[model samples]
Target: MKATQALTTALKAELRRAGITYAQLAVHLDLAESSVKRIFSRGELTLARIDQVLALLQLDFVDLAREVAQATPARQALSAEQEAAVVADPHLLLVAICVQAHWTAAQILETYAITHAQLVAALTVLDRLGFIELRAHNRYRLKVDQTFRWRPDGPVMAFFRQHAVPDYFEGGFDGPGEQLALVHGQIAHARAADFHDRLQRLAQDFVHQHVADQVRPAGDKTAYTLVLGMRSWLFEPFRTLLRMPGAAPGIAPRAQARR
Candidate 1:
């Protein structure tokens, strides 16, 4: 993950993203396909040669650097200490969630009541914890990707379980696009895995739709949280009759209304 290696990796990614094959790049660079492959494999191209590649891709060095920066993240799952620091202050926790949603400082200021100084302080702490990369003018870049997730039993999730959960479930869920359901059943392990895979794809589709709806006007959009859960569990009363009274096991299939 050295600087040179990162740049080379980004170059390769750009080529793939643009659907430009090595053979095509060979023609563009006026070199043999094997030679082009060797140069990419070794990542031993001169600055001029790299510039030529960038020209063919219609991208500049800055774009490649940005891609490299994005490809490199502050590893998934923060240490316990980091999670504790985030939950130490409620305002900081709110800011952290906003950052996870890619909210800009100005947008946060417009929506939340936190002071500008407080926001900056929280951003500084996140940068120190390697959760984000703070930049000038209160700008920052999220240091995690879609695969990034909170430690299940970490302090942040514990905080949510103790606080946010109550608030979240307090809703009626009878309103438009809201729902609450509970089901119990048993299924084979392999089918359960397939169920998990489909649930993951549904979650990803929700994410894609969120991104696509970002262009809508604020008035035309309403914030909604989609909580997905699949586990082998039965009602406590029912579980009391099962073999393992203290644990829940197996799975069942449930229908989604709109998904």
Candidate 2:
């Protein structure tokens, strides 16, 4: 499916799971119920209106955009020749490593086992591409606005951390502790599906609530499109991996006892 369509589908599903009727959403947005219905039915809302909804529902646009982008198939598949081109570019490797939550050149070199000159060359290329900026002599920070398209073999963790993870779960929780709380709550209630469902709804409600307030009567209708997409492939695997009895010692009390 197209990125826009995928995002709209995810957003609509989220609204449904929230038990928030169109009328209630309308009231919250201070718009006519019919208009809210039209927006939901059309699955298109102005970015400004979306902002309003996001503020109300406490969702982040960057996260939603990341989800959509990740779920959307690449516009053009990489042929062998194209793949070779990316592989030839040493900077791509540096870009990949910097995309992680917190990484440095020294750490990258140590982890990847590369020489100082090789690391410096890679960082220089990445800096030139605007994918990264030098924070200090050897320190760098990722530019979240930049878009990257590299081979799948080129560090999937960096791709997901820099791109996907930030997009879907942004603002839902501030830290790992908050995320663990949400996950634990879901497990405690035996509602993993519900937890996922609620997350989707939260994103939609946030957009709707915001858009209704910010959008002017004569605003550009075409400019308003809410795109919400998620990458289950990237995250679900990690979730499953972490949930294994061997992964969480405290949580897997039964498994520990059996041992």
Each candidate structure's TM-score, on Cα atoms with residue i matched to residue i, is 0.69, 0.27
| Residue 172 lDDT, candidate 2, scale 0-100 | 43
lDDT of 2 by residue, 1-259 (tens): 7665666665553354333466767887899999987886686787777776656544567645654564433222333454444346555544444542235565466666667777777666655655455433455444432123344455443455567555654444443323312121114434545655665676556445543433223343222212333222223454566746344322211100000
**Evaluated with lDDT, which candidate comes out highest?**
1
lDDT of 1 by residue, 1-259 (tens): 8887888888885675444788889999999999999998898988999899999977778767886877854576789998999999988889888887667688789999999999999999998988887766776666766556678899998988898777887777888787777666787889888988887788778766765565456898778877667766566677788887666565463534221
**Model 1: residues >4 Å from true position, as ranges?**
1-70, 243-259
**C-alpha RMSD in Å of predicted model 1 compared with the true structure:** 8.2
Query: Candidate 2: which stretches are off by over 4 Å?
Result: 1-87, 145-259
How far out, in Å, is residue 236 in model 2?
A: 21
For each candidate, what is the lDDT?
Answer: 0.78, 0.49
Candidate 1 TM-score over all chains jointly: 0.69
Q: How many residue pairs clash in each candidate?
A: 0, 14
Residue 46 Cα positional deviation in candidate 2, in Å, after optimal superposition: 42
Output the number of the TM-score-best candidate. Answer: 1
